[model samples]
Target chain A: MKSNKTNMKYDIIFFAVALIILVFLFLAYFFMTRSNGYICEIKKDNKIYGEYKMDKDHEIDIKENGKLVNAVVIKDHEVYMKEADCPDKLCEKMGKISRVGETIVCLPNKIVITIKGDKGSDSLDSMTK
Target chain B: MGVKSTKNIGITSLFLALALVLSYIETLLPVFIPIPGLKIGLPNLAIIIVLYLYDFKTASLINVMRIFIAGFMFGSAFSIVYSLSGAFLSMIIMTIMKKTKKFSIVTVSSAGGIFHNLGQIIMAAIVMENYYIFTYFPVLFVGGIITGIVIGIIARELLPRLRKIIGFEIKGSE
Candidate 1:
């Protein structure tokens, strides 16, 4: 009897919870679908370092061996890491970014940037704008 | 009642008490919450133990009650709105997976841990007072998986003795 009454109170509690989870899932789905951008992939030594959103215009100058090489954001959808002095020149071959998941890495200087879809609150432009 | 049933209930209660203790202990852990309701799930150790030693039904019942009471007494009880939801989702996932072939104690416990975190995130998002949490989810998802695996192994080791205490024998004889 005691457990049942306690259970009833809990049922009401969980029901409220169910409603909340549903609301959040709806928001996540909405926010995710609303954002359709690209990611800038940066790799070091063929290893993925991290990814950043490509929704804004930012300048990154790749300096290898203390010399300015490549720095460009191709488009809202494409990015290029060209004009590096590295002998391998693998990142230059990554070409243009056409999709959400693309990479531009400079291994010699130990810097990489990958374009990913919808990340945390670092970039306020998406929500504010 | 029969000795078997009595023993089962006893074991379950013991786990329930253990979970309560772990829950209280976790509450004391340091939190740097620029956002709300975010913390590492530690009571999950008991929940995982329950899922492994007892059946899903028992674990579910205990988990629901544990979270409910603990939330009120130790946490923001009035915020049943968040606690119940997060705890329920976590318990449900853990219970369902408890019986699956791919669902070892480790996997189920880890799922519980991850879901617990996800559930809370969902609630926080709804209280929708903040969007900062939405940004760090990728980090949370990967973190959830890692923590789940670690907690899973701990639950797996504790399962055997727990089963015996509950008067249930492990398969494959003594």
Candidate 2:
């Protein structure tokens, strides 16, 4: 007798989908590769937060609550509140950014540094659109 | 069989207890290895075991108990939405796997893991009123594969023995 068909043929589809997942993850990591970034100049109360090199791995210094604070970030220069003493350092753990979606927000310090495309469009559009 | 039968009730309760314990234990553990948006979901063992041992409906009910009770106990009142979303999709996967009974535990559990994560992310999207949350899918899928294989192996080993106990015991004993 001819070989009878058994089991679903769709398992092949699952394997293919898994392969796609692996490839997509690689591409995501590649797109987020480490690199030097633009130096963002921060100013507060007309006082300088100093110029910082936005490289793959670095942090910039800013004084908060009468003390110096360091805000580190990943490539693409997404600023986050790495260390601050404003009664709550919640923003410190917000972590680095490689994606183009949002900003590292430190409401206590009134600081909001967002990442954007080359054209520097609005953060909302680059993320939502 | 009488509901009072000790063997019948004992076995079901044991698995239920196992599920609950696993749920609580998972929450207590420190969670590292961020995959953007996915739960390690180590508690799936009880469900998978019950699916193979007692019955699908039974396993499903236990899953619900685990989610709801765990949610209540954690006092993470805000996270109810996320828990329900993940539970809903994961249950759907489990139901399909129980019915088909033709796939390896690894494949089925991986799908279940993926759906569970998808459900939570969908809920997060709804709460945030944004679709950008979908961007986390890739990382979540990768996490699913890893967690699923680990959990699948646990269930794979536990299920056969559990089934053997149920097979020789009174009805509903598993």
Best by lDDT: 2
Tell me the tens digit of each residue's lDDT in model 2 across B92-111: 78678757756667667778
List the candidates' TM-scores in order. Answer: 0.51, 0.66
> What TM-score, to 2 decimals, does candidate 1 have?
0.51
Q: Report every candidate's CA lDDT.
A: 0.59, 0.61
True contacts kept of 2: 0.08
lDDT of 1 at B174: 33
- Superposed Cα deviation of residue B41, candidate 1 (Å): 1.9
Clashes of each: 15, 0
Positional deviation of residue B173's Cα in model 1 after best superposition, in angstroms: 20
Docking class of 1: incorrect
The sequence of per-residue lDDT tens digits that candidate 2 reaches over residues A1-129 is: 222223334445665788787788667544543332354444443344454555555556666675776554444545555676543344565566544443344433544444444445333345455
Q: What DockQ, on C-alphas, does every prediction get?
A: 0.02, 0.13
